[model samples]
Target: MALRRITQETFDAAVRENVDEFEMDPDEALREAVEQFQSQGVDLSCIVKAVPAATSDDKHQEQTHEILQALESLSVAQDSPDSTKAAADIKCFTEQCLLGFAQRYLAAQKGAYPVILSYCQKSMGEREATFAALSALSALTDGQPDLLDADGKRFLLDALEQHQDDSSVTRAAISAVRHACLKHEQNRQDLVKAGALPLLTSAVKRHSGCAEVVKEASAALRIMTFDDDVRVTFGHAHEHAKMIVLQHNGLKVLIDSAKAHNDNITVLSELCATLSRLAVRNEFCQDICDLGGLKLMMTLLAGSYESAELVRQVLSAIRAVAGNDDVKDAVVKAGGVQLIVIAMNRHMIISAVCEQGCACLSVLALRKPNNCKVIMEEGGALAAVQAMKSHPGVVNVQKQACMLLRNLVSHQPNYSQPILEMGVEALILQALRAHRDCGDAAKAALRDLGCQVELRELWTGKRGGITN
Candidate 1:
């Protein structure tokens, strides 16, 4: 059964009661509160679960926290005449924000979002102040998506459009957009409605040499292609991706940027992810090939053999574009299959890299008998077997490895004898028994590899229905 959930305020009240009324120590009171709520089958994962240190004087009792105090000071400085003091105060708050997202979360719960937003609104004309406030706002809203309420979204888009001439401000504002729309679907649509797509792409072009700007803009573009919202019944992921690619020359822009920053692993990783997201159409896949994306990915794959994250992203990009048949031919012609096997060999212990590598090989082998010969000759079968054994508990690794096994023999059943010699039968059987999500994949793999499966019967002229 699911545990019942209580709000943060309720838990805080209970803790406070135990401390102030019962006169218990703060630590003991917090533990007692947690025990009391959890005894009633309550979920406490979302609760902060920490006590704020207290100080008292004759005039005041239980004063505000460090974050709350800093917010109050920044609030007062917003009206002060001394620009230097105001900058210093805001700077202090920005330093506080740099501590971590927990401090930022506590600040937002204490109403810091609106205060800092108002500061941003008032600091527009002053370049230094505007940059500082935007930085603080971006930090404050990092993981606190609730603070984006309509006004916060408007300000982020406005900041993007208003501050294009300044790379620092543009980077900061793009950072805020990347954070604001991360899991918030409405914020994504609203910003795109107000013209954020072109501005983001243009920023990448205007500041291609600025690694920080390119990185942030690339991340923002990728975040815009997410379908991660749980609040809405439907998301605009496909629509947003199409708008970015078809209307904004996203393929050209992203590929060109990737070319410029080939040596920068961070930027290259982000561009690889963005390229994967843009492969939503058949022609889009062909476009990626036509724009030299396939060759670029091949180069990155061979060059970044030691970078686990970059190699994983590169494999994913290859998988995405291989949805096109011609592109698959091109990848195989470019020795993509053998490079994938080498990547799996290099990062065999890393499950993510191995999983993507196997999945990419599976795509390359689909419906192409010649590719299967290359996979077998290049030890792709041995690599898949090792990935399954290394990460037995990882369902994705198991499932993709199973599919790769199946694709390797799908069009060429004569190759099954060699794969079976590698002892993949027991592993496939294990996956079939372990994960229900991958049962069909494992079954298809076994069947295509010329293994016997317990066939089910459903047609004996049953009167009303087929067998269940």
Candidate 2:
């Protein structure tokens, strides 16, 4: 008989009798039928509807579970060349079954998180199983917010926590949480509070040379620490906070990672930013200083022209740590003053990084007047002013220049008189030509410089009507 015209009565019997069929032999006839549909390029929704409703018999239930399990496996293997043909065939069959069950299928069955998590932990040697569970979680999380409740959340957390010190399991578990955290803010907060930071820190320390593990651990912490609510949660985890500080080797490891593997800029940049956040706070500045973070940051900033983002982040990390005079003195002593000026225009290569570098330079100037002198001597001030004029095609860079202007004037008020003397008013006024937040920043900086005749004339030449 042609598969297309299978009688509704036969399909109904299949559904009713094989209520547990999915868990059983996986209904080869059903599998073949779906394969035919796939081969013919037909949608299987109608065909899926033809399957009968599941029977209530216990034996049938077992069979149905098996079928579902098989379907899940097939769903995951669809990409494998060896399994593609069979997997595609099974997808069509499972689609029909899933279509028949509809939302009821999803609703009637428990979400696959527990099963998926279990498979991932035990199947480390089996890349396919680990991949399959990872793929399954993507679909399950897509639909079910309440799928994994508090108990389920706790279970995954505890299981992952147990493997916190194990890099492979840590990587997988962190990957799993990356999705879970998005499902609910509370889940993210719970993970942070449950000692994830320390575990991640430990993993970073132990597996310092393992690029992938460090990347994953850093990524997990990024998601957890990104939101303000999660930050507060991190704050409450005082012991973990201390652990992050005491794990003094993390900064050096990250610095070494970036230096040793230039290809992993993305990973290394994230690690730098993550550590900056954790250790940049006032309480942790001393730890950062003791660990030689200032010198490492200066090296990155001075040398990393290829990765503007990493350099910018390293600079920000320095700012976070440099709030202390000793740290700032260390930074100045390490020649950070000379580097910040060159970074302003040259490393302004990326708009975001340029913005961050600009801010970092401003902070450095505020801390060390001699650094401000380096900025001026290197024409860093002029470069900043021109960056404002050329405007880098990114609003953030313009804003950073304007911010740098504000910092320069505020930190070196007397020295900035020469900048005004050199006709920088026109440049600042040019940035203000655009009526936006950046323009506002430019205008505010100029206004703060007070009134000077050269500055007034420069503004007038640019058709900037300044009333002072």
Give residue 377's lDDT in candidate 1 (0 to 100): 93
Considering every candidate listed, which one attains the maximal TM-score?
Answer: 1
Per-candidate TM equals: 0.90, 0.63
Q: lDDT of candidate 2?
A: 0.58
For residues 1-468, could you state the per-residue lDDT of candidate 2 as single tens digits? 343444333444555444455543446545655565457655444333434333355545533333354555544554456644533434343343333333323322543445444543454454444444444443444334345456545545654555555566556556666656653556665666665566666666667667877787676665554443432333333343344555534455555555555456667677677666666456577666666566666766766756677767776777677676666677767777567667766654456656666676666666466667776776767766666655545677777777677767776788668778766677666556654667666776776566432333334445556899
Candidate 1 has its poorest 10 consecutive residues by lDDT at 52-61
lDDT score, candidate 2, position 277:
63
Candidate 2 off by > 4 Å: 1-148, 158-167, 182-184, 228-243, 246-264, 421-423, 433-436, 452-468
The TM-score measured for candidate 2 stands at: 0.63
Task: Give candidate 1 regions above 4 Å deviation.
Answer: 1-61, 455-468
Summed backbone clashes in each candidate are 0, 20
Model 2 lDDT, residue 212, Cα: 78
